[model samples]
Target: MHMQTKKNILFLFAAGVMLAGILGTSCKKDAAPDYGIPTITRVAQPLDSASIVTGSFTQWVIIYGTHLGSTQSVSFNDQEVPYKTIYASDSSVTVQIPRAIPKDVTNTVTVTTKGGKATFSFTTVIPPLQLTGMLNEYTAVGDTLILTGANFDLYGLDTTATSVTFTGGSTVNIAGGTASTLKVVVPASAQPGPVTVKGIAPLNISIATVAWYWDNRNFLFDMSNFNGWNGKTYLSSGPDPAPVNGPYFKVAKSWQGGWAWDPFCSNNCAMPAELVNDPAKYINYALKFEMYTPLNPPALPLKLYMVFNSGNFKEFFYDAGGGSYPYSTGGKWRTFTVPLSSWGNLQGFTFSNPIIMEFMLKDSNPSQSNFSICNFRMVPIN
Candidate 1:
């Protein structure tokens, strides 16, 4: 009986060992996943496919190559940017360059994926200087004028690296300003011409050559070379209401009428015209004139019509709709601009001789006729 029991115990041990081996084989871990190597061939702008090798900071770009869909990290010039695996694909990855200023001067973009890493030659370009506008174009001497735009700090614009020149070839001193605005003190030498600006190394810009101050570029009737034709008038030599560069045309005439065609024009002043003697080119220009009306002025403004020339074509000093210019300076001299192109709707139009401009009263009942007009000129709006 003892021998038989020993044999039975040995058989049971062998069976148990075989069962353990079968369980081990069934529970083997799954093969490790296959992750392909990643590489970047080039960078480009999204949608346009424009191969952009270099770009400014914070500009969005696409990395094109193989094995990028599993991107784990992206860096421009060693500046790591926030990225996601979901937004990436095996062929391309869209990312934005970080806004932070990079300390690492490595002009290359590095990308790392589950498979491998890639470093692409790329340069980060700085923002360039751009000019927009000059504030208070008619700034008096010693007064502060501002230049408006972006990236003023980039150039360190001051009296040193930046310059401000007026139309007549006079430059002003910088008064200091912020990143988007530049302040300058207008010198006594500032003339009436296009404003010019210069900055460090290849930064030169010119603006407003024909639009700011009242100039003599295309002067017409300013009560000097060309006087008024007919109207009760006198030149304002001034103290009261202040004197302009020149006296108002036949200063202050009492205009009283009820929708009547009252006349005021240059008796024999025919302009020299613009652009190769083509007066039609005046259409591109702005007709500017200084006008003054006494306090509590007219309900409807003055009219310039071809009543003596063609009768159908007419324009207002302002865009007052046909002959309904409701402009009033209220006793202070103010410049009025009338874009000649605004008259494109006036049929039967042509710039030629017999340019008899008849200024009429447009009110059903207008006040006195002593309105002043001077410095008629055609200038660019710039």
Candidate 2:
């Protein structure tokens, strides 16, 4: 009719140009993706940073290698550490830090993750090298003193802190270091009281420098010797005797022939027999007795004979007869803590040279046994 209506308009313009080239090849294969500029990974800072303690603990950090995940964050010095409590599959972290971080310092640690940000600068936490002022009351053998205070600047008086020990063979020779002072030389079988300074090496790795001393009021002990046990003096061996209660202190089953005071202290058996004068002012004080026995007692081999000041009784035998104060849950109430420095030279005996600490309990496995002495105390620990 008009050439068949222009051949149906040229077949609808070639089907609209084949549907616009198939929507431009499906929008160039579903486009939308640039994602660039992002690739960082840095994390390494942990040799065990902060230190110094008077009390309270928890400071362990390792953070070595291997896919450290969990979108991290740990900074301290630049702030923003918001109590970071994390275990995170063990990349290691305990961080509680702050007991002493002074003296010529430096401390910084940043760790932001997702593969980015890492910084480290450490050193600073020194306050436990204090060997206070002491005017000496008695320190035998070639005595040469003067061991002042303030971190002694890593103490190197005579090459790695040359000499200082006293348990009976004495040795002291630090002769050096002076900003505050430290020039020692008291080595003559040194004994007599208070001279326990410490620090061999370790200003890092959580910190360690304990052994400072200077409170030698000459073997401290007061409150009229804790009001009881008659001016102190009671060892055992004559019919089970070494009692005190009102402050708890006992160990009676004597040991010559008696055997059975452990697990049978008649509830307040006169308060363990009385004499522990709670004079709390210890420089390193210690005394905690606890006993328990009877699984089949009566002699499987047992012997306990205690005597101190009965003539300096071997200077306070800590353990030799058998029950220097046994503890393994035999009857119950078990808690021994004797550490008057193990009574070397009869530690702290001075109510005018008075000391009589005793205890003796034996059963020699004969099968007629029983034992018990629940609690006793004389505390102070650093």
Best by TM-score: 1
The TM-score of predicted model 1 comes to 0.49
Query: Candidate 2's residue-wise lDDT over 1-382, tens digit each?
Result: 6999999999999988888888878777665444222222222234534442221213434443333344266544444344456443324333444433333343654456555555555432444545544322222346556555554554433243545555454555466656455556676456544455444544321121232222222222332244334323322222221221112333323344445333222111111111234222333655544344444433212433333433434333345215532323443333344555665654443312244444444354423323444233343445
How many angstroms is residue 221 displaced in model 1 relative to the true structure, after the best TM-score fit? Answer: 2.5
Q: Which stretches of candidate 1 lie over 4 Å from their true place?
A: 1-162, 174-185, 198-208, 212-214, 231-234, 250-257, 264-266, 292-313, 320-333, 345-348, 368-372, 380-382
What would the TM-scores of all predictions be?
0.49, 0.28
lDDT (C-alpha) at residue 3 in model 1: 98
Predicted structure with the largest lDDT when compared to the true one = 1
lDDT of 1 at 147: 67
Number of backbone collisions per candidate: 10, 28
Q: Candidate 1, which ten residues in sequence have the lowest lDDT sum?
A: 299-308
| lDDT score, candidate 1, position 325 | 45
Evaluate model 1: give its lDDT: 0.63
All candidates: CA RMSD (Å): 9.9, 15.8
